[model samples]
Target: MAKLFLLLFTLLNSSFLFSQENTLGNEYCQIQLISTEKSPSVNPPIKNLDKEQVTLLEIPAGKSRLRLNCRLDEQGVFTFGNDEILDVSWEALEVKLVPLAASSPSFLLPTGTFSIDFVFLTHHNYKQNFVWEPIVTFLNASLLNNITMGVFYGLCLTLILYVFFMGRVVGDTRFQFYSLYVFCAATFFLLQEGQLNIFLQQQSFLLSHQFYLLFAGFTVFTAIVFIVRLTDLNTTWPKLTRYGLEFGAVVVLLMSVLMLFLNHNELSALLGSAMARVTLLLMLGILTLVSIQAYRNVQSAKLVLLSLVLMVIAMVFRTVLHDVNPFLQRYSLIIAFAVEAFMLAVAVSERIKSIQTDKILAESQANTDALCNVLNRRGWDKKVNEILSEQKIKGGVICLLYIDLDNFKQINDKWGHDTGDKVLKVVSDIIRNQLRSIDSIGRVGGDEFVALGIFYDRTEAENLVIRIQKRLQAVSLHIDKQKTVEVSASVGHVIYEEPPKGAEVMLSQADQSMYQIKRASKQG
Candidate 1:
């Protein structure tokens, strides 16, 4: 949070640098090559420096290039390079551009020439290797870049953590791939900015370009996988897109891994770069094609298509059109990443919501009896167990009503199966109507049903049973033009003041009570 505020504060103070005259924010020191000895790479072989900055690929093994007279605003200027001398007469310094890699490895080496033949030059070139840019100018130029990098990394990290937290709630599949994708992308961009130095003993990730390619490829691979899962591409375009997407992701990933292991000499490095670029192009083509097709039918995919297009534009600014606009080149990828991460995060939440909804509907369907319009045995046990498990309801009176039709098989035999089904439906409706809304009913058998309820006492429980029985007895459900059958049940209930462990014990006691009622009725 503090870092985020710092970034904002830096942006707000952008005009401060230009107002300071002592800063020399836009000025370059005047330099002149006075001596005629000049390296071939140096443009003007002699005299005054003009027209643009100088960059050297290499300086000859041991030969000195030239003598330079650099004039500052009386503060003076000097080159950060190898062992050289300054002639005070003309303020002239020898120009010998020996980069660190080309210098001696010995720490004991004398900076002075081996004119003292008794001693070996064994020490590193400890001289400073800094460019001639004012500190304020560097900060001013890099202000936007610093802000962009901070926000980009900050947003990516926050989203990753958010997704992981959600993963714990919903499940790992919801956020794992998406978070990994973001992580790899963040790493790739960090490498691109060349900010991650000092790893592998001062070798910047910029030097190991393979890691750059590696992470870049991984970002694409995980992104494709995330999209495939998010849009449910397999179930929809199984054969059409499945092979193409998987193949592309796998090939790109494989090539990226391969680049890391290869011995990258000049030719190898060239080939590896070419391979990485080609794989990227191939994967992007595949991604674009798949996303466009998915967008037409899948509503969720519209966001995905937009993210991909925006990402492509960001990449163009970061790479191909970098010289077109400095702002776009520096911050375009960061903007793209921020937008893409947000869109993906939303997509993931939607997926979680959809999964939960589907699960609920599936459970409902599985535990319901269509014919009776009531809970099936599974759902009955579930509801009863829930009621019994609650200490509050169990402390009062929980009545488990076991209902069995007296002549259900007889009705089926005499009036045909349709009449029997209608009778059961009618009986379920009558029982439901008699009981309170909090009560639950289920069809446990062909003609056996169970219901659960809470009441004030035994009197209230008996009153409910009486109402159900009376309603069932009074039902004159017509079977056909020839006859009508009375919809009735033998209802036996067991009231639990202190609920038992589970549902089955209460059900067994109620079933026994019902059998006794049925036996006495048969005798009468």
Candidate 2:
């Protein structure tokens, strides 16, 4: 009976040694046993094994399983260790942590000191000799870390969705895919880091892992898509790297399922990490190459090159560090997202600007007469109404002038239309040279022209019309050798202080006065 009590005491003591109030509270000796192997000690040599409290159990050589774990403290001291009894072979080690306390609603385990042996795996042959210890687990993170990651997740998702939705209307495929890729990368990091578990009532085994894998795959795919698009790689490199990315995507998709179901997590993780690094490098390198080519290849790609430079710098800092402070991580994604989104926005804006410019150019061309470079008759009529509408409310005088060239068709009949065209051009240039920038001129008849000007006074308006007629009369044209013709114009004008009697009324008043003067000149 006494011996039995002693054995019980021993059992309690052993349990006490392994258990603690909190792993975090006992920071000095916090150890996580991730994996173990029961095999021959001399199979594959292990490195960085601390020689204390580590037990070895053996089964055979080169057949041991690897167990891995991470230990952390408030001081930010983090260390990873494995408890495979034998040396590790080249057989890869994969560790998948469920962290039930993080995902389970009723996850209250204990509030006091305790310890539990976390056994990852054992040799298939050594199952009978030793029982695997249950895992030690806890869920403790600084509120700041949790909140930082949470905010980042929300912000990134928002920006991504905004871009995609905007892109739908804007018809920019590059923005659409870029947003998708950024969303995938942001969400995957959140899930993998266990930052998004707060929202889930209960974590679905398949959903958690599978969704993570899906996002990771999509992130890689979208990155490749962006590279191909940004570089126009099909026309540029167009070689093995392009084909390899396509093939890699397929392989990654298939293996992601297998990795989840078959518990080939190590293989999956290693490949995933490797693929991530490779994708980042390839994308950045391709972008750099494209930027160099852009300098010489196209002048418009300068912005594209600048944007790529920013992305390359951001990615290099992101991937190299094993762990980043939560605040920095959150900040990094925000800044990077802003930069990328801004770049895309600029590209979209440039396209919109170009379209608007083209419309303006077309409208200008449509309003102009090709031969005289004056407003077309229809354009002048339209503009007159627009100006009158404004002047009606604002209270201003609009001056209209009618001018007829004397014997102009006789010159066309005698000198040929080519020279007649030259004379017309010369006359149009003279009229344009005499008017204020505010005045508008139009050719309203075969050899007649009309001028419209807005003025605050009738005196300035009359002076402008007289100056124009005098300028035209002084014009001299050489019709042929020793046959130079002196040209003169009959001018008539009217000013409307209020709304016009009618557009046709004002026009006819000016026209009839000009014809009367021409008739008087011919009779004289």
Candidate 3:
């Protein structure tokens, strides 16, 4: 009986020691990670783990999954830092958390020589802090990052909407392309910064990553197009701009297709980043060349060049120090983009203003007579119609004067065409000087001119015509040192207090009356 009691007591003591050794409590613990690549399940047994192949790691206070070879018999809160309770899975031995606050929750674990595996979903430097410090720091950084990105996106959205509306209003293709580029770049930054994942409930990291690449590709493509169009590269550097835009199109298509098949793996991420960098370099090179070529002649191109230079510098800095400063790496591009958008907006405005000015100048040139710098026949007709319409409405008298230079062909044949041209110019100057500023005068044909004047009565019209006829007759052209030639004009007038059938009828009546005066003058 004594031996049996001793044996039972020894067995119970040994069981208690074994249980104590297997239990894990609320303390800092190191874990071993095993890649279960060949295992049928992630929860492989400890017996399958090779001690030499396992890597030891400390647990972090963020979302992570782990496979442990031990089991938890008691339910306890698994805390990472302060008050945050991480989602723990005993069956799979996984903990997922986003440590928003500072607190570490205790976990009671049954210990054994178990295979454990951990995967962190958030990026953090493990050696920076031991407990909740890292989590707090990361959360703070993330908050700041989100705030900065949100403000940037808001500004970009405003610029995008403004440019889109302006593009429609101005009917400029360059504005449309620039707006598209801004939108794509804004979306790319949002995805790259994970803003979409936070705001859009349905968005995943993988989807955002894929879309980041897609918009990045489109942004480059559209930027190339915008530059080409804005600088008039098709006219300035035709072959190079054509080929560059074509290549950009192909790259865009290739990247878009690649996005469809991307799985968001490390290799894909690396390749996408490399492609983006290469595209950026290409764009910078092209823009630099274009800017240099156009800076002297194109004011808008200078602004565009400045914008590109700023963006390229920012991009190069980000690329160089991306691993060093997380905040700059993530947000520098957005800052650069904001500044560039402002500069580009100014460029677009200036370009539109230039276009409007040129259009007005072209219309003026189209309406003016080249020789006498007065209204041409087309302009005269337009003015006469306006006067007739005004007379009909306001009950005013308007007189149409049709004047022809007498024996003009004889003057041209005897004294030469140069003398005849001088005589016509002198006659135009006399008519212009005699008429009121409100009157319209035009050289309708060779040696034939018409004037429209407002008057109070028919006597006033007759007096004005007689004055113009006497002034034109007084004109003389010096053909050479030895001789001078004189010229005279036959004038006819028509007065209307009501709207005529049309300008054509008034013009025809004036022409017949002028021919009658010419015939009487010849007979006399």
Using lDDT, give the best candidate's number: 3
> On lDDT, who's better, 1 or 2?
1
Report the lDDT tens digits of candidate 2 across residue range 1-524. Answer: 99999999999988876675455444332332233333323334422223122223333322334332223232121122121111122221232223333321111222223333333332122211121121231223334556666776776777677767766765658667767777777766665555445556433452355566666677767766754554455556666446655555555555554545543335644655565566556565656666766767642356667666776666544434314442343345445655665675565456445545777888888887888888887787877887788788787888888888888888888877877777777787888888999888888777788888888878888888889878976678764455566667888888888878666787898899889878988899
Which candidate's TM-score is highest?
1
Instruction: Write down the TM-score for model 1.
Output: 0.71
Ranking by lDDT: 3, 1, 2
Look at candidate 3 and tell me the lDDT of residue 207: 38
Q: Rate the local accuracy (lDDT) of all candidates.
A: 0.63, 0.58, 0.65
Q: Candidate 2: where are CA atoms >4 Å away?
A: 1-26, 29-113, 116-196, 202-209, 212-289, 297-300, 309-337, 377-382, 413-419, 443-448, 457-460, 477-485, 492-494, 500-524
Please identify model 3 stretches exceeding 4 Å from their true place.
Answer: 1-172, 193-199, 204-207, 265-274, 321-331, 392-395, 454-463, 478-483
TM-score of each: 0.71, 0.58, 0.68
Name the lDDT value of residue 446 in candidate 3: 90
lDDT (10s digit) by residue, model 3, range 418-520: 8778777777888899998988899889989999987777788778888887877556656556658777889887887767899899999989988998898
